[model samples]
Target: MTYTARSIVWIVIYLLFILLPLFALLAGSLPPARDFWTEFSAALGYSGLAIMGLQFGLTARFRYVTEPWGEDVIYHFHRRISLFAVA
Candidate 1:
């Protein structure tokens, strides 16, 4: 499938959250320090904000479809990621 810009952004998110963090904990040997909770929380917050940004873009760019099947796309992605994570 040809990935559009929206797909690219979420692919980046997957890299940042699912891939980078995984490596950070394993290969990187990065310990969660005393202030790790704050850092981790901020990272999570950024991830959420990224999703919000995508949502805003999706709404602005696809208002017609957003009115009809927008949420289905979101759920579809969510389900795909869920299965991906499970694998």
Candidate 2:
């Protein structure tokens, strides 16, 4: 499969957004002083919500984000993410 420069850029942007929270957590103070499971679960929830929101935005049909992968690919990805959201 071929990817345009814009598409490659979009991929990096998406990945960075997904990692934003982890980077935030790591770049800040140590959290071991806090409840591990509680913080971990909260982080997971926040990450999942962010991913879900991105999934919706991915369907906005913007050529810059969807062109390299195509509309069908984006829609299928959205469908898969929707299923994942229920879990």
Candidate 3:
């Protein structure tokens, strides 16, 4: 699949805003206190996993692109993320 520059930028922004924090939680690397980090990480990880699953379901339902430029870019990112979630 070919990714446009807009799609790449949106995906990067999505990762920064959504995925990065979740990843830190999953890794128990979010700072301040190590003891609490693990528990917080566990909780956030579960929530993040649930959100990811929901996104996957929604994206998988979209078999074709029908939106305009920005929305289409978002769908493309969603499709890519859905694939990553499956893996």
Candidate that would win on lDDT: 2
Candidate 1 residue-wise lDDT, 31-78, digit = tens: 556597886765565545545445444445455434434667766765
Comparison by lDDT, 1 against 3, better one: 3
- Per-candidate local distance difference test: 0.54, 0.80, 0.57
Clashing pairs in 3: none
Q: What is the per-residue lDDT of model 3 for residues 1-87, given as tens digits with 9 covering 90 to 100? A: 455764566456545655555665567655565587786766566556655855754455444332224456557766786666555
Runs of candidate 3 exceeding 4 Å displacement: 1-34, 62-71, 79-87
Candidate 1: stretches off by over 4 Å: 1-3, 26-69
Q: Write the per-residue lDDT of candidate 2 for residues 8-71, one digit (tens) a residue.
A: 7877898788779777878887766668789888788877877887986898999767778889
> 1 or 3: which has the higher TM-score?
1
TM-score of each: 0.36, 0.73, 0.34
Ranking by lDDT: 2, 3, 1
- lDDT value, residue 2 of candidate 2: 49
- Candidate 2 residue 11 Cα shift, in angstroms, is 3.0
